[model samples]
Target: MTGSTLVGALVVGLAVGAVGRLVLPGRKAVPVWLTLALGVAAALLGAIVVGLVDRRPGGSPLLPLVVQTGFAAVAVVLAVVAAGRQTSPDPAARRKEEV
Candidate 1:
């Protein structure tokens, strides 16, 4: 990827990640670093998908963005779910033990 593309990926990733964090309800226990990482991954995935379909020399600038955003949405949701699974404690598993 070009330097500009790399920067774009980072920017997109950060935005996607922030959105993911916001979309999740309840307590947001996710760390900023993790969100950033998820964003980067989502951006990468989106870029790959777009690259696969966007093989033309030139075309509308909006379609790729839409694809990327769509991918970002899916990725962000999945990331949130996965993060939630890992971060959320099992309510049933925690028995009330008296000391």
Candidate 2:
């Protein structure tokens, strides 16, 4: 990947991580660095996947970048749900119990 593409991935990743933190309801447990790392990893994984699916070897870099950013955003949300479950109490359980 070119230097610009790398930077773009990082920027998108950071944004996704920040947005994920906000979307997750509850006090922050994971450190920012961890979140950022997860985001970056997700971005790279997403980009690679997209490239492979498109049958473009090595990937178009920029096209994959956009796809990766969007996917990274989704990944962040999923990650929050998966990882945050243990740390954040489930309110739905309380509601069901109340009823």
Candidate 3:
């Protein structure tokens, strides 16, 4: 990918990732960096998917943007799930539960 494409992906990723996080209920143990990375990857994947599906010689820009955002949302959900699995329990909570 070209530098511009990467930069665009990053920008879109940041926005899409933030929206994804906002849509989910409850706290996520995922770090900001991880979320950002997920967003970036998702955005690129979304772009690729849209590019493949769109056969028009000159397609509308809106469709690709929407598709990319959707992909980012899916990635965020996965990231959140993974983060939930990896989060360490608080010692106090564990002790309380044991008691």
Candidate 4:
């Protein structure tokens, strides 16, 4: 992609990532960078899916935005879950430390 296109994608990605994090019920443990990366990926993937599913020359612009946001929300959830798993302390280790 061109430099302008890349910059535009990053802007959209940041917005999508913020929206995605907001969509979740609770606070997420994911970092901002990860969220941004996932958002970009989601946006690209959503575009591809929309392209394949809706081939009409003139389609509602909102569809792709909604799809990308949905993908971003899912990506945020997955990232939070993965981060939690990695950061959770071992129960046994915790007990030993408490001793």
Candidate 5:
């Protein structure tokens, strides 16, 4: 990809990550690296979905922006699931029940 494309990806990733974090507002053991990784993942996933929906084989000039935004929203939902799962420990403790 070109420098511009790379930049676009980074921007999309960061935006997705930020939105995801906001949606998943809970205690997490997430570090900066994980957040960044998740963002990048979201961007790629979003782009793929957009490309599929728009019938863009690779990527178009205007598609990234729209795809990124949509992807960020999706990332938010995924983040909420991840964060909620992380924060809420197993309510049914097998050991406690056995005792």
Candidate 6:
């Protein structure tokens, strides 16, 4: 990919990530870098899906953006859940602390 294309993708990814974070309910502790990375991945995946589903030339651009944003939102939720799992204290530890 061209430098300009890469740059454009990064920008879009960042925007998508921010939107995804906003769409999620409740507070999330996801890092910015992780969100950006997930957004970029989601954007690429969304493009691939769109390409597979819609082979027609001159298709609407909005569909791809929507799909990417949706993917980003899902990614954010997954990231948060994964992070939670890693950071959650053990049940034994929790009980000890409570005691």
lDDT of each: 0.69, 0.73, 0.78, 0.70, 0.65, 0.70
TM-score of 2: 0.63
Give the runs in model 2 whose Cα sits over 4 Å from its true position: 55-62, 87-99
Give the per-residue lDDT of model 1 (tens digit) for 1-99.
456555667777888778778777866556767876877777777777777777887757576566666666677777667766662265654444321
lDDT of 3 at 32: 74
RMSD of each: 3.9, 5.0, 3.4, 4.1, 5.0, 3.4
Question: Which of candidates 5 and 6 is the stronger one according to TM-score?
Answer: 6
Q: Write the per-residue lDDT of candidate 5 for residues 1-99, one digit (tens) a residue.
A: 346655776788887676566656666556645676777776776666655677546546787777766766676566556654553345567456556
Displacement of the residue 15 alpha carbon in candidate 6, Å: 1.3
The ten-residue window of minimal lDDT in model 2 covers 80-89
The lDDT, on a scale of 0 to 1, for candidate 3 is 0.78
* Candidate 6's TM-score: 0.68
Candidate 2 lDDT over 1-99, as tens digits, reads 556656777888888888888878886667777777888888877766764577756555577767877778777777666765563268887677668
Q: By TM-score, rank the candidates, best first.
A: 3, 1, 6, 4, 2, 5
Question: CA lDDT of 94 in candidate 4?
Answer: 70
- lDDT by residue (tens digit), candidate 3, 25-92: 78888877778789989989888787678888677878777877788778988989877766336888
Which stretches of model 5 miss by more than 4 angstroms?
48-60, 86-99
Q: Highest TM-score: give the candidate number.
A: 3
TM-score-better candidate, 2 vs 3: 3
Pitting candidate 2 against candidate 5, the one with the higher lDDT is 2
The list of candidate 6 runs beyond 4 A from truth reads: 1-9, 21-29, 87-92, 96-99
The alpha-carbon lDDT assigned to residue 23 of candidate 6 equals 72
TM-score of each: 0.71, 0.63, 0.73, 0.67, 0.57, 0.68
Query: Which prediction has the highest lDDT against the true structure?
Result: 3
